[model samples]
Target: MSHHDNKPPKVCIVCGMPLKDKNDYPGGDTSLDWCKYCGTKDGIHPYKKLLEGMAKFLQQTQGMSEEESKKAAKQMVDSSPAVKMGKVKVAE
Candidate 1:
């Protein structure tokens, strides 16, 4: 088998979330590179879509203001593996 077959679960490149279960993957597709929130059956969502989702998650979970959540989300997105590796692009 390929070495990749034994690799451990990957953290979501877009949101830094751990993909530790089948439910964590898009359509339960463990073969996908990103997590469920970052994609769907159609494949990875757009950068803006990911940013909004992360920002909303931050706001709801951390009780941060909308601006604060958005700022944090932007930072996470800019430094994310997908962004750094050029798998995903940021518009600005």
Candidate 2:
């Protein structure tokens, strides 16, 4: 089997959220590339600002510490394919 099999998604390309299982979040399928908060079967869930909000989301939802959440959010965003391709900008 490939390395992808049985492994949960690492991160989201559109919103930079660390994804878990397909049903772990409300709208995500995990079988896809982005998280439920960022996308759904129909289309993307639009958001204006992300940098701070992502960190806040992680903290509030996952119980990550303030500093840890910020750091993790930054890392995910910086490495996402969408960001690399200029399709998304967390700071904007």
Against the hidden reference, what TM-scores do the models get?
0.86, 0.47
**Model 1 misplaced stretches (Cα beyond 4 Å):** 1-8
Lowest lDDT 10-residue stretch of candidate 1: 1-10
Best candidate, lDDT: 1
User: Which candidate has the top score in TM-score?
Assistant: 1
Native RMSD of candidate 2 (Å): 5.1
lDDT of 1 by residue, 1-92 (tens): 34565777688878878887778998888787789988886767888998899999999999999999999998999899898989778987
- lDDT (CA) for every model shown? 0.86, 0.66
- Over 1-92, each residue of candidate 2 has an lDDT whose tens digit, in order, gives 34676766577776646776666454544466666665566644433445566788889989999999988877766676877777665463
Q: Using alpha carbons, what is the TM-score of model 2?
A: 0.47
